[model samples]
Target: MVYDFDKLWNYNKPADTEMAFLKLLPKALECGTDYHLQLLTQIARTQGLQQQFDRAHHTLDEVEKQLNTQAFPQAAIRYLLERGRVFNSSGNKKDAAPLFEQAWQLASETGNDFYAADALHMLAIVASPEQALEWNLKALHLAENSADTRTQKWLGSLYNNIGWTYFDMADYEKALALFEKCLQWNEKQHHPMEVFIARWSAGKTLRLLQRTEEALHTQTGLLKEMIDKNMEEDGFVFEELAECLLQLNRPEQAKKYFAAAYNLLSKDIWLQKNEPARLSRLQKLG
Candidate 1:
């Protein structure tokens, strides 16, 4: 309760967040309620986010050493969940699934529906599309039924993931529906960043569905909202708007947004790696 891991939640830079967690560890240890171990769990998570897999593994080992299955049910579930997450993030879903399943079992036994839903959600992520949908639906059911506020907040994430899975499988209608659901849940949270993300997904899905005008409208509105709120400027939205304009034959507007997107996104290593072709086209437009 005293240790605020929430501070790390919105930090996009995992390496910096990991350092922040490390700085808090000694002070957290003095609190004397296995708080240090909980902090270690978060540190391991940040290491995984930073792609420091081996260091993340070592941190989890330390967690394993301190974890008591009987005495700390919640912590035990978190340890297993974090272990599964590390393996999942490291691209070892085969190893990850069992850990998530075990965590699910532990959470169920402990009557912790929030963690149980989380394990199911992770299982969905690492599974095949059809199996993933099944798992996701089950997780959604648990989340919806739980009285815990944390579980309720998971609605947006579950919808977003399922939406993307549908999108990847080329089911645009289903994807759009789920993305809309995500947007609805995010609106309830009134978290600007999350709402932006949900809108982005919805707009992208609209583009995939060839609803160019709708996609353009959605992205345009979202961009204005972000600008008004001084929210994190997402290059993806600009790129999406550009593409939508291009599809609608507004070449001049498209070119402008393409240039804007290029200026913002060209430095992103992940974009450079995964979307080189699209980036190249954006550059050509610029």
Candidate 2:
């Protein structure tokens, strides 16, 4: 099993990942039909992540034509998972759920714990708010107990998802605890960006818990760290800083950060489409 597709993926830069997979296609073809088909599934995934939904579907269609369920079940599982992801990412969750369900069942039956966990995580994303926690917990349990290191790598993300679910349910304390756990997991894994994201999650939860000073400290530290590391400025960090300042009755200081946040976050296509109200509020506040 020379399935090293993970090395080609950079979830934040889907276009780059797509190109990487495209470059690897010839090599995959030489490996075997199973490897080729599985690689195509990942290419489709990269396309989906880039919002190239039609192209992704076409790629998956090609994979399906060569799929052999009996001889290469893993490839089949990958195809279903990628197809479901494309539908889910395109806001067609209604059609996506069954594909993920099938993937989950097939992956579990095949003893592919990694894809089974992936399917469960995707299900958590598409599930109703009331059912999301259950799906996330199921995925988390599977990942935690898996002997496979790749499967266990899901723990940080699972913790973050569970934390957000709790946050949405108004269980701030629980959310904070889970976010802290996520932070610890990422730190242990030595994933710097994931650790930073986890810290951001915890900071936001702190504000919601009325720990204003602590939240302010955390956001300020993140801002300083980003500057020191020469990392791209995150609008969410600025937004959190502004929020903390506002909560402390320092409107003047808050306004500048709000302006900075809006200037950057307004350029986000997903935020523009899905969170217009939030952007509008930032605009008005700024």
Candidate 3:
């Protein structure tokens, strides 16, 4: 029986995903050594995503002991990618970059366009701003040209990454354009959460471009849509709405949203660890 690892992933809930992967281990083992090792790599990835870097490394280390790069090349690629992710998430981009590069090279040589694009996208995350765009564009082009649907599925994320790359470069127009493209792509793919995120990105760029009214409209629409869909409230959406309201000189309305944003976002472990100042500002504003 062929197991689909993608079915086990829930990126928004890494701890739950970790448990799901652990439960699948027996089935994976019955499949074969290759499937087992590949599954182990993903277990390590969940650990990394949850900020358990040491545990993630240890998990990858166990996988490495049994990994034969020639016999299990796909597993080897996954191991490299997961290990690199642990390093990158732990603030060791210098160590992560070489592993991502190696994975890219190996995957490309093995005709694994999906993993190749994955490696390049990881490279973009660790690279400098100037180099990040280069990596993202390279990954985007590869995904666009690949005949493999798995590889082609990377296009939406690539578009979002490139949009943020442009956003960080302070080219708001280009960022907005790419984010709009991301929105369209996600809509076509029927990924509701991704479409929401893409809309948020585009709205944020509008505010940066000094189109405050339009930004406010966009964010308000998103908030209404989320409520209408009975979706969980998004802190980022609240944050954006606060910013838009503040820009429009509505301090009382902004304060309410700011407080809501802080209440939700302050619970985010990654933000608490990496962006204390941002949280502080939100608290003060609230």
Candidate 4:
């Protein structure tokens, strides 16, 4: 646990994650302890951030070797979730399905409702748009059964996710309503990530509505917050904001945003050569 937390703080989304390797002793990990599983999960997450997919799986395997199935059902659920996440990240949704199912089943049988709900949430992400609603609604059911405030917040995130899925499925009316309600949960929690995501979603849906000026105003705040936090902004976010700017007949402002987005992404050598949208936008600006 100490090691994991230390690594998180030191990195704190630091760049060049492949160069950020700090090895942990296998013996330091005591299976079934909250900290142990947390360490394993963090290592997996770190590898994912570094884009080292195989390394992440190897770390999970180490944790698996130490965990006993009979004694650690909750941990079992966690392991499956982590593995499923890696598969999802790697774009291997089919491989992730069974893992999520196993975790969901274990969480249910063990009365670990929160874990069950979490599994359902991730499972829904991998499912098709048509099938996703069932998974999310099932997750909501399990979440409703829990008494924890944190659990409720998670369920709220699940709802937000469902709303996004609906939006992707071309159901704007449903998406807007769900997102509006999810804002209440985020307000109560007042977490940065939640606020950031909620605003992003709102702005996105408004754009779909052709409410260009409103969407620009909404995302502008989020952009300032991201900059203030010194966090990396997704190029897609900036591109979308520029789209709104163009719709608002603000090509000058659009040029600024387009440049900013392309520049930020262009710093990464790999993406500089690879991202046609950003690169082409820059060329167009020039």
Best by lDDT: 3
Clashes of each: 0, 0, 0, 0
RMSD of each: 2.3, 1.3, 0.9, 4.0
Q: Would you list the rank order by lDDT, best first?
A: 3, 2, 1, 4
Cα-based lDDT at residue 177, candidate 4: 77
Alpha-carbon shift of residue 228 in model 2 (angstroms): 1.0
Tens-place lDDT digits, model 2, residues 1-286: 5768878789999999989888888789888998899999999999998888999999999999999888999999999999999999899999899999999999999999999999998898999866889999999999999999989988999999999999999999999999999999889889999999999999999999999999999999999999999999999999999999999999999999999999999999789978999999899899
* Model 1 segments more than 4 A misplaced: 272-281
List candidate 2 segments past 4 Å from native: 1-3
lDDT tens readout by residue for model 1, 47-120: 88877889999999998988888987877888889899999877799999999999999999988988899999
Candidate 3 lDDT over 1-286, as tens digits, reads 6879869799888999999999998788788989999999999999999999999999999999999999999999999999999999999999999999999999999999999999999999999878999999999999999999999999999999999999999999999999999999999999988999999999999999999999999999999998999999999999999999999999899998999999999999989989999999889999
Q: In model 1, what is the error at residue 140, expressed in angstroms? A: 0.4
Q: How does model 3 score by TM-score?
A: 0.98
In angstroms, the error of model 3 at 12 is 0.7
lDDT of each: 0.87, 0.93, 0.95, 0.74
- Candidate 4 structure lDDT: 0.74
Backbone clashes counted, model 4: 0
- Provide the lDDT at 78 for model 3: 95
Give TM per candidate. 0.89, 0.97, 0.98, 0.80
Clashing pairs in 2: none
